[model samples]
Target: MNLQRFEQLIAAYGSQAHHWPVAERQAALSWLQQQPDNALYCQAQQLDMLLNQSVAPLPAPQLYANILAKICPTPFRDGYFYLCHWLWGESQWQHCWRPALLLGLPLLLGLFASGLSTPSVEDLLWLDLEQSWVLMMAGHEMDL
Candidate 1:
C-alpha cells in the first residue's frame, strides 16, 4: 500500500519472481505495469543483475588468514581509550529520576515559598522604627 510496503515486498520476493506467491506476483506485475517507463525501474533491474554475480574463490589457508587479518584489525587504540574510563562505573542510580526529583523539587519549593513569605514594606518600616527608637534611647541615656 505504502512505498515502504512496496519496497519490503520487492526485497523479499522481487529477486526471484518465479518463487513469489502467484497472486501477489500478479498484483505486483500489475502495479509495475501501471507505472510508465522510468529511471527507477531501469535502475532496479540493473542492481538486481549486479546482486546475482558470484565472486572468484579464495586461494589457500595463508591467503584466507591474510584476508582475515586485513579485514579484522585489533580493536584497541590508545588515543581515546583513557577517556572512556567511567566515573561512577555504571551505577543503577545513574538511570534513576527519583533522587534528583527528591532533592531538586523541595529546594525549588522552599525558594518559591520563601519568595511568597518575604517581609512587606510595612514590616521593614516597623523594623526601621524599632532600630531608630533604640538609637534615640541610647543617645538619651548617654546624655543623662
Candidate 2:
C-alpha cells in the first residue's frame, strides 16, 4: 500500500498490526518496514497505549429501572404490549396471516349470516303468484 493508505489504516485500526483488517495487514506491514521512522505510526502507538490504559465509566444505579419504566409505563398495560410484541416479532410470513385471519373470520361469519337471512329467487316468485291468485278471486267476487 502507499504511504497515505498505510497512515489511514493505522489511524482507523490503531497502531497494532493485529487490529488491522486481514486483507490489508500485509501491505501495511511492508509499507511500515520501508519507512521505519514513520512519525504518524509513533504518534498512533502512543495514542493507542493511552486509550488502552483508560477505564470506562460505570452507569447509574437506576439505569435499568429507568429503561424499564420508559419501555413499559404501567403494569396493567404490560400484558397487551407484550402480546402485540410477541405477535409482531415472529417471522414475516407467519405474522402476515394472523391479522388476516382475525379480521377475515368475523367478516366471513357476517357474510354467511346475511346470506341465510335474505330471500331466494324461488321464494319471491311463489309469493308473487299467491298475491295474483288472491287478486283474481277478489275480482270475480266483485263481478258477482
Candidate 3:
C-alpha cells in the first residue's frame, strides 16, 4: 500500500491486521510482509498504544441540563414580517434581488405572453374595399 493509504489504515484500524477492513486486510498484510519496518506501521503502533492507555476521562457533568439551560426561545415570524424582511433586508442591496425577481418575472412574462397573443390596433382596423359593375344590364329594374 502507498504511504497515504497505510497512514489512513493505521489511524482507522490501528497497527493490527484483524481490526482492518476485511477487503483491505490482505493488501495491508502483503505490504507489511514486503517492508517489515514500515514507518507508518510503527507510528500506528505508537498511536494505538497511546489510545489504549487507561487515562481517566474528564467527567462531563450535567451535559443535557447545561444545554437545556442555555436554550433561549425565539419569537416566531409570520408572512407579513417575512415579506418585510425580504424586501427591506439586512443588506439593502444583497437580498433585494430575490424579491425583485419574484415580482418582475411574472409581470415580464405576462407582458410577453399578451404581446404574442393580442392583435395590434392597426391590424384590427385594416380593410379591403372593392366593387364590380355591369354597364348595359345593371339599370333595367329602376323606375323612371
Candidate 3 structure lDDT: 0.74
**Candidate 2 Cα misplacement greater than 4 A, ranges:** 11-13, 76-144
**lDDT-based ranking:** 2, 3, 1
Off by over 4 Å in 3: 1-3, 55-144
Better candidate number, 1 or 3, judged by lDDT: 3
Supply candidate 1's per-residue lDDT for 86.
36
Q: lDDT tens string, model 2, 1-144?
A: 898899899888889999999999998998988897898899899999988899989999799888988886787677878877766658898688877776689999999999989988999999999999999999999999
* Candidate 1 lDDT over residue span 48-139, tens digit each: 78877868876788998889777876465433453243322356764355556656899999999999999999999999999999999999
Clash pairs (backbone) in predicted model 3: none
lDDT of 2 at 4: 86
Cα TM-score of candidate 3: 0.33
Expressed as tens digits, the lDDT of each residue in 1-144 for candidate 3 is 676786788777889888999988889888888887878788888878887887897758788667855683334435667777777667767477877887799999999999989876765555211112342234644533
What local lDDT score does residue 25 receive in model 1, on the 0 to 100 scale?
Answer: 74
Kindly state the number of residue pairs that clash in model 1.
0
Error of 3 at 131 (Å): 99
User: Rank by TM-score, descending?
Assistant: 2, 3, 1
TM-score (all chains, Cα) for each model:
0.28, 0.42, 0.33
